[model samples]
Target: MAIANESRQEEQNMREEHHGAGRYWLIWVLLLVLTAVTVVTGRIHIPTWGLVLALVVATTKGTLVLLYFMHLIDHRGANRLVFAVSILFVVLMLAIPLVDLGTRYRGATPPGSTVSDMQAIDIGADAMEGRFGGGLRKEGKTGEQSGSPRQ
Candidate 1:
């Protein structure tokens, strides 16, 4: 009976070790396939959808790395909650700039209009030209100009 029990225990240990190795190998293959998919998708441009697809692939890869490589999948309760909160903060940081961009008025600045106001400065033009001197100084107009030799 003791011999049989020892043999069974050894078999069980072998099985467990095999199973763990197989699982890690499978995950490695899957990660490689995902990397190939990301490379393929990146090379083929599909306009707006291209960026979206790349982001999806990157997010999937990141999640896989976090779960398997970081050993977060085996963790429970508080560890999972902390990771979830961290993801939420990351999303919030990305979302705030997008929200600001989306809420901005498209027609706020018309093309080829030189009117100086809040809109002109916001649209990235030289709105404070008068205070900074509009153009090149005349040759003999001022005492500072008279000191310089004219070519």
Candidate 2:
């Protein structure tokens, strides 16, 4: 039928739009150059904008892979819309946890130290003080002497 033939023609046109071996080789070489840039950025510490530059390079590489290798360029608009939405969700997922961690209190507890170490550091009445700074009024409940805090 004419409809079947038209569909085949459209499919052929889509195939033609796909890049040839030369185009792929060019993209591959560009990707290699970007990779070299990434390695150089990793070696030298730029402090402020180092992470930003690395992210930009990574995003560029990802975009190239998606557009060419994934064949998203010749795909439907809906496919691109779906991809964009997914990316937005991924960003939101990473950003929400970062916000939570950023707003939290820093160094509330001693890093990698035990309770015995804390007691050794500050003994007697100071050791009896709780995490929130309230000293124990009555002790010996957990099998210590009639007076004094837990061991």
Per model, state how many residue pairs clash. 0, 0
lDDT values, one for every candidate: 0.65, 0.70
RMSD, one per candidate, in order: 9.7, 9.3
The sequence of per-residue lDDT tens digits that candidate 1 reaches over residues 42-93 is 7887764675677667777788888877777765555688889988887788
lDDT of 1: 0.65
Candidate 1 runs further than 4 Å off? 1-19, 108-151
lDDT of 2 by residue, 1-151 (tens): 8657765766788977756798778888989999999999899988667856887789789888888777777766566888899778867876787566546554543543431223334455664545446656444346655446544
Q: Give the TM-score of candidate 1.
A: 0.54
State the lDDT at 4 in candidate 2.
71
User: Which candidate leads in lDDT?
Assistant: 2
